[model samples]
Target: MQVTALYRHPIKSHGRECLDAVTLVTGQTIPWDRTWAVTHEASKADAAETAWVACHNFMIGTRTPALAGIWAKLDEVERRVTLTHQDLEELTFCPDDPEDVAEFLNWVAPLCPENRACPTGIVTAGTRGMTDSDYPSVSLMNVASHRAIEQAISGPLELERWRGNIWIDGAAEWEEFGWLGRDIQIGEATLRLREPIERCAHTSANPRTGQRDADTLGTLESDFGHQDFGIYAEVVNGGEIRIGDKAVLQ
Candidate 1:
């Protein structure tokens, strides 16, 4: 298999950024992936600790599918985030400032559904990522498997719905499931496929429209006999990875 694309999510449940190349580090997720999260007002996660908390404590595609419509761009040099959406004007702010954080909260409050918990604050991860998994891991997706799901659903689906960190082509459909507890080499990086990622309600949402238009979970369970579409891997050997890099099972 070959690496067809690379992506990073600077903030949890926010927009995705495509990359041509990136430096992977051992025991860490992709650069800046899920570095920050919008914590809900009713969350019980202690703000004082930098530990990984359940994704329910923060904004997520499952509860607020509209969040998928929000496009976020991070300026690493300035430590600022700029958010853009189809219905709202672009807003940029430094999340570190209390005043700026408040402005961001106000901007996002109206986008949330009434039944979901409202966002109260923006939180950052110090040395670790706030990824969905408790461990620092990167998500890997197989394009062939994605096509299978599309075929099963009898409709087209966007890759963004998967929110994967690495997308690979040329792999046989569902071949990744056999890779659990195995090592794969991509360019100079060696990663251990830890487990198959289970499907979630978020996958049903359309990334462009934020509408729950697809029954991704249902199709996976009924047609595929499973509720998984991707795999999570840990970077055991750090190295540079780029688009078009070959991925070989080790």
Candidate 2:
């Protein structure tokens, strides 16, 4: 197999950025992936701490599908995030600045449904990323399997819907399921296939339009008999991995 793509989500439930290469660290999530999350006003997440919290405390695609329509660019040096949406003016601000945070909240509050918990501030957990899985992991996807899902639905599905960190080609459709407990080598890094990633309603939203345009869960249940679309792997040996790197079962 070969690595076809790489991605990083600087902020959870927001936007993603593509990378050509990355250095993997053992027992850690991909670099800058989910480094920040927009916490709701009533969220239990403590900004002063560095512990993982439930995803519900933040503005997420599952709760606010409109977030998918946003594109974010993180300027780490400036400690600012630039959010752009087709229907909204471009907003750039520092989440660490009180005044800027309030500005950010004001800018995005309208996009989020008031009935749901509204985002109030930004939160982070030190160096670790806030991954969906409680454990540090890198999500992997099979291009063939994604194509299978699209074929079953008789429509095109954007890969960003799944927000995988690593995408591989050359694997048979759904073949990664059998890889549980196996070790896989990609470029110079080695990872242990942990478990199949369970699916969620967030997959139903189109990343390009921020609308619930597909019944991804329904299609999965009806055709595949499960709501899983990818796998989580724990980095076992740290090394540099790049797009087009060779992937092999070890």
**Candidate 1 ranges with C-alpha deviation above 4 Å:** none
lDDT to native, each model: 0.87, 0.87
Candidate 1 clashing pairs, residues 3+ apart or interchain: none
Error of 1 at 83 (Å): 1.7
Against the hidden reference, what TM-scores do the models get? Answer: 0.96, 0.95
Candidate 1 lDDT tens digits, 1-250: 8999898888789777788998899999998888888888777664733578878898888888888877777898897888887877799998778899899888887779998888888777754788878899999999999999999999999998999999999989999999999999998999999999987898888877777999999999999899998999999999999999999998
Per-residue lDDT value at 139 in model 2 = 98
> How close is each model in CA RMSD to the real structure?
1.3, 1.3
Worst 10 residues of 1 by lDDT: 42-51
* Per-residue accuracy of model 2 over 159-187 as CA lDDT, tens digit each: 99998999999989999999999999999
Q: Which candidate is the best by TM-score?
A: 1
